[model samples]
Target: MTQDELKRLVGQAAADYVKQHVPEGSVIGVGTGSTANCFIDAIAADRARYRGAVSSSEASTERLRGHGIEVFDLNQIDSLPVYVDGADEINALGHMVKGGGGALTREKIVASVAMTFVCVVDASKRVPVLGLFPLPVEVIPMAQASVARALTAMGGTPQARVRADGSPYVTDNGCTILDVRGLQILDPVAFETSVNQIPGVVTVGLFAQRGADLCLMGTTAGVEMTDYRN
Candidate 1:
């Protein structure tokens, strides 16, 4: 099957998993990117079953609203039973390199509140170790250079993310993204915490601190569900 087909299969699996597990009237935390978009489309059929969604990115929020699903502000929601998103890379330990779309800050925030985080991705995204994909780090615009230097000192090459127009890409939070490459991350939690301590850094792409509780990996055979907590 094509990669897109595989992504769609896992997206549907994630939707089905949410429907079967999350209780009725619960607010879901939705994430960004193409795979998450596929999941949003799949879940549209079951929209009425849940209260609404707390979206991690403006793009996902717009998509959810387009489907006539109400999106509640995260600040207002007391409980978020489930959060679904895609990963750029995921290790066996469930740590992820996310924010390829530059939504790390909000994704982390939404995931923090969710009781269950369900990561949906195609099998190609599964990696023995994270960091092959350049890890995204959001930073304050003025501190971009400073943060880049700090990231470089950490043994990675940090490049400022730019748009197709050759202009700096700005995130939803009015920050910039530094795509850091190099370095095989063997220790996820420690690396995550260390990067987060940089003065200008908003948030690193690492999701290890509160990694995926479950992962739905799509392959030609079928979707393989792994509960990381086990």
Candidate 2:
């Protein structure tokens, strides 16, 4: 199957998993990105099953609302049972590199409040370690240079993200992103902690501390489920 097809497959599988595990009328946390968009499309078929959703990005919020799924503010909701999202790269241990679409901070916040996080991805996204994909670091606009220097000191190439027109790419939070390349993350949890401690760093794209509780990985064979919590 094509990559798009694989994404749709896992998307449906995630919707099914949520249907089975999450109780009716419960609010769920939704994430951003292409794969997560597929999940939104699939879950739309059962929109009534969910009370609403707390979205990680404005794009996802618009998509969810487009599907007739009510998008709720995180502050208005007390509990989120399930958070479904996608990853850029995921290791054997289930830690992931996300934020390729520049929604890392909000994604982390929504995922943190959820009882379970279900990551959906294609087989190509699976990796032995977490750093093959450039690690995205969201930084305050004024402190971009300082953060880049700090990241360089840590042995990686930091490039400020840009738009198609060559202007700086600003995130939904009005922060800029520095996509750091050329570092192999052997220890994701430790790497996440250290990067987060960097001044002006809003949040690293490393989803280690609150990584996937379970992953629905799409392969040529079908959707293969891995329970990280187990």
Candidate 3:
């Protein structure tokens, strides 16, 4: 199957997982990205089953609204029961390299708030290590250079992420993304904390020790579940 088809299969698996796990009257956390879009589509088809959702990005909020899923700000909700998202890369331990769509900060916030985080992706995204995909770090434009230099010192090649319009890609929170390459990360928690210590660093794409509760990996063999819960 093509990548799109694979993504759809994985997304469907994730949606099914969420539908089975998230109880009625529970507040859900929705993330951004194409795979997450597939989950939203699935959820929308079963609108009456969910209570509401807190979206991680404006784009996701719009889509949720189109599907009749009530969207709320994070502060508006007392607590989130489950947060389902897609990862750019996820390791066996459930650590992920996110923010390919530049919504990492918000996505992380929502995921952190949820009781459980479910990551959905194609099999290609599963890896033994997390840094193969360029790590996305959101930063303030004023400290972009400083942060880039710091990441470089940490053994990464940092590049300012730009838009197809040639402008600096601005995140929903008005931050810039620095795609960092060339680093083989082993200790994700330490790396996350260290990167966040940099001035103007909003949030790095590294989803440290906060492992996913479950992962839905789609492959030619079909959808498979990685249940971290024991």
Candidate 4:
């Protein structure tokens, strides 16, 4: 199957998983991106089964609302049963590099409050290490240069993310993204913590500190589920 088909397969599987695991009338957390968009469409068939959703990005929020699913603000919701999202890349340890679409900050925030993070991705996203994909780091616009310097000191190439039109890619939080490359994140937790301490850095796209609790990997064969907590 093609990659898009694989994404759809996992998306359906995630919707099924949610129905089985999350209780009725519970508000779940939704993620951003194409794969996550597929999940939104699949889950829409059973929209009434859940109370509503807390979306990770404005795009996802619009999509959720378009499907007649109510979207709730994070502050209004205390906890989430599950956060279903896609990962740019994932390792055996469930570590992920997200935010290719520039929603890292919000995605991380929503994931933090969830009881379980259900990462849905295609087989190609599975990797032996976590740094192959450019690590997206959200930073204040004025501090972009300083943050880049700090990232360079850490032995990586930090390039300011830009759009097709050549303008800077601004995130939902109104900050710019620095896509860092060339560092093998052997210790994700430490790497995440250290980068977060850098001044002007809002948050890195590393999901190691609170990585995925479960991963639904889509393959040509079918969806493979792994519970990291186990």
Candidate 5:
């Protein structure tokens, strides 16, 4: 199947999984990106089934609003019952590499507040280890150079991510992204912490120790569940 076709299958499976697990009247945490868009579309198709949605990006909020799904600000909600998102790359352990869409900071915050984090992805995205995909690090524009130096120290080659218009890619939070290449991450949690500790670093795309509770992996046959909560 083509990439778009595969993404659609996985996205549908993910939406179906959420509909099955999420209880009515619960505040849902919605993630950003193409796959998450699919989930939003599915949920919107059945608007009355959900109470409200907490979006991780402005773009997501607009999409949900367009469907009449009540969108709540993160500060407005104390906690989210579930957070459903897609990853650029995910491993068997549920560790993920995200931020291709520049919403990593918000995605991480929402996932952190959620009771359960559900990752949805196509089979092609599954990897034995993380880091094959360039890791994204959100940094303060003022400290971009310093943060880039720190990433190099960590054995990665850092490059500024740009938009299609050739301008620096700016995130929803108005931060910049440093795409780090090279380096196999052995301990994701430690790496995440280390990167965050750097001055001017907002958040890293490496979701190491804060792994997902469940995974909805789409395969050629259909979607398969990988339950890690047990």
Candidate 6:
């Protein structure tokens, strides 16, 4: 199957899994990115199964709403049982590199509150280690270059994210992203902690600390379920 076909399969699998597992009226946490968009489209079929969703990005929010799924504010909701999203790269340990959509901070926040985090991805996304994909670091606008310098000292190539128009790409939180490349993250948890300590860094894209509870990886055969929580 093609990449988009694989993503659609995994997205449907995620929706099926949640509809069968999550409570009838529970609220959910949704994530960002293209794969996550597939999940959003999939979940629309069972929109009434859950109350609504707390979205990680405005793009996801709009997509969710377009699907007729009610999008709720995180502050208004106390508990999120399931957070379903996609990863840029994931390993056997379930560590992931996300935020390609510039929604890292909110994704972290929503995922933090969820009881379970499910990552949906195509098979190509699986990797031996994190960091093959450029790790995105959301930083305050004024500190963008400074944080890039700090990332450089850490032995990574940092580039400020820009739009198609060559303007700076501002995140939903009004921050800019630095896409750092070339550092092989052998220890994702430690690296996450260390990068978060940078003054201008709002949040790193590493999802190690609250990694996937499970992953629905779409291969040519089918959607293969991997349970990390086990």
What lDDT, from 0 to 1, does candidate 3 have? Answer: 0.89
Q: In candidate 4, which residue ranges exceed 4 Å CA deviation?
A: none
Q: What are the candidates' C-alpha RMSDs?
A: 0.7, 0.6, 1.1, 0.6, 1.2, 0.8
Compute each candidate's TM-score over C-alphas. Answer: 0.99, 0.99, 0.97, 0.99, 0.96, 0.98
Count of backbone clashes, every candidate in sequence: 0, 0, 0, 0, 0, 0
**Candidate 5 structure quality by residue, lDDT tens digits, 58-145:** 9999999999999988899988888999999988788899999899999999999999898988888898878889999999999999
Task: Show model 1 residue runs off by greater than 4 Å.
Answer: none
Backbone clashes in model 3, listed as residue pairs: none
- Per-candidate Cα lDDT values, in order, are 0.95, 0.96, 0.89, 0.96, 0.88, 0.93
Candidate 1 similarity to native, TM-score: 0.99
Q: Which segments of model 5 are wrong by more than 4 Å?
A: none
lDDT of 6 by residue, 1-230 (tens): 89999999999999899988998988899999888989999888889887899999989999999988899999999989899999899999999999888899999999999999999999999999888999999999999888999999999999999999999999988989999999999999999999999998999999999999999999988989999988
lDDT of 3 by residue, 1-230 (tens): 98889888877777777788778877799999999998898888777888889999999999999999999889988889889999999887888999998899999899888998989899889889878899999999899999999999999999999999998899999989999999888989899999999999998999876768888888899988887886
Where model 2 places Cα greater than 4 Å from the true spot, the runs are none
The digit string of per-residue lDDT tens for model 4 on 1-230 reads 99999999999999999999999999999999999999999999999999999999999999999999999999999899999999999999999999898999999999999999999999999999889999999999999999999999998999999999999898888999999999899999999999999999999999999999999999988999999999
> What global local distance difference test value does model 2 have?
0.96
N/CA/C clash count, model 2: 0
Relative to the unseen true structure, what is the C-alpha lDDT of residue 65 in candidate 2, on a scale of 0 to 100? 95
Candidate 5 lowest-lDDT run of ten: 1-10
